[model samples]
Target: MDSPHGAAVKAEDFGLKGPRGWAFRGIGLDAAPGSLIAVEGPSGSGRTCLLLALTGRMKPTEGHAEIGRHRLPKKMAAVRRIAALGPVPGVNDLDQSLTVAEQLREGALLQRHYGAPIRSLFRSRAERRATAAARIDAALDAAGLDLATLPKGERTTVRDLERLEAVRLSVAIALLGSPQLLALDDLDIKLSDTERTEVWALLRSIAARGITVLAVCSEAPADAVVLRTGPKEDGAGAGRDADAKAEAEPAAKAEAEPAVEKDSGAKKDAETGPATATATENDADDTGNDGNDDNDDDDTKGADDALAEAGRA
Candidate 1:
């Protein structure tokens, strides 16, 4: 498909195999600019690996991909420039100790040091600084991260911030360059439900601005194109089904036992009614447990809040 922003991302027959075994295979995707594509799978399903290949961070064993006008190369510097990654933020390999503003400044400086003209670097320091400030402001604004809210604001160190904040900071740094394609890994790792919704909204907004976003998530969002990665083992699906059954059995028993106890209680008012009451209590307890189990399952099946937030941002 053609991209809205004039940059298309395609991965054809992409497969990645390692010393252990095949991480992923038969992966093919095409994302238009302004679209959000989600790679959905369990942990260790090669989502991150696939992301690397598509973004030119790692080479696929059997196929290739294209970002914008540049094809994947043995060296991916060109593609990396146009595709900013949200994972690990700041730099591609981040320095964990740096403050938020320092990381942003360093990122802009590095981009200039590598990509800007030498004369421009020397002759227009003020202009360069202004450009960096504008880009940073735009990125932060887009991310819904107000530096002023932090105790140290821009001066707050990455290590000092919470995980969600760090994720946002990383996204802001990635946006500093105004990349054509944004690739994020595990956009929602750990966040509250409200936070997750906000994050997803932010990602959609970013896509609306004409950047293609490819994100790795455990569950697919409504607006994204979902890619499924199956379970790790052959009978994993069966095992999961069995586990669900095991969880439901106790609740079923509790409900059924209560009815039996009620039937038996019809003969006596106090003594038999005690048995019925005990059964009712057990049913309540089991129902509560079942409810908790269902909640746990939902959490597992849902997207990671931190990653989701980053995607939305």
Candidate 2:
């Protein structure tokens, strides 16, 4: 389906090459309204890079990418308005000093402060506070975060919460703007399997509500349309062929041995018995050809007599 913003995202021949000569290339993708796409690859394989490009946070060196109706600009203000990016774990940028409730309230206020006209800024204080509070509460509820359950019930700082709770708070802050597109980076990083499952379920539920969801993960979820990046196609094929060759070598060697042994055994039997019989016949002929049989006997008898005399002496 076409997005209300015209096109949700479009990238053509997008690529990024680092100073170290490592590169990720050959990417072409489109994400539309009500669509959920996932970028999956091993560490350093450019999944995060691609996600950033699609969200207009980073520009591609070679190709063009668009989010909503705007091409990536030197400044991403327009794209940032229509899209919300979730926080990266371990990054100290999610307002760690503020309480969960305060963070959500601040997020909504900031979006309004930046986007609203200056004429509206001078509105009555009571009306503005009521609007901001309602928006913050709605965002927190949608994220399944209840600040009332915290130690000080809306006054608890982020530093006091567990890692999972912090992540949920970050999600709530992102959702406060009610963006048309949600870009989540490393959604499953460091999460337990069950926690990952829960997060995926939440994302799916969000997508079901009609927001386009794009996430970068080490592996793709079952319901996500995965865009994978890694080695070149030829390199992958060569590796598979090499593995197949290695597996076949042992079986080929095993089949060859029996034929060699049979040939050697036949040769040995053919030579041994005949050669021994011929040697015996030659010995008999040599004895028969000693025509001076009596002389031979006399010489043998003399040798025996000499040995007997030596023993007696």
Compose the digit string of candidate 2's lDDT tens values, residues 1-313.
1122323776677664433232357787787775778888765566655655465433345556667665642223345445666654322145568666555544554445333335546767666566556656666666677777788987798788866667677766666556677777677777899888878887786777677888878889887877887764333222321222233234223322332224433322211000000001112222323222222111222211321211111
Which runs in model 1 stand beyond 4 Å of their true positions?
1-6, 73-75, 89-94, 117-119, 232-313
Model 2 ranges off by over 4 Å: 1-7, 73-76, 90-92, 117-119, 231-313
lDDT, candidate 1, residue 50? 66
Candidate 2: clashing pairs of residues? none
Q: TM-score of every model?
A: 0.68, 0.66
Tens-digit lDDT track of model 1 for 1-313:
1123725777777665543355566777787767888989876676765666566444456566777766653324445445667753211434577777666655554444333434554645466556556666777887678999998988888788876677677677666656677777667777777777777887888888898888888887987977776654433232321222233234324422333323422212111000000112212222223222212111111211211211111
lDDT of 2: 0.52
Indicate which candidate wins on TM-score: 1
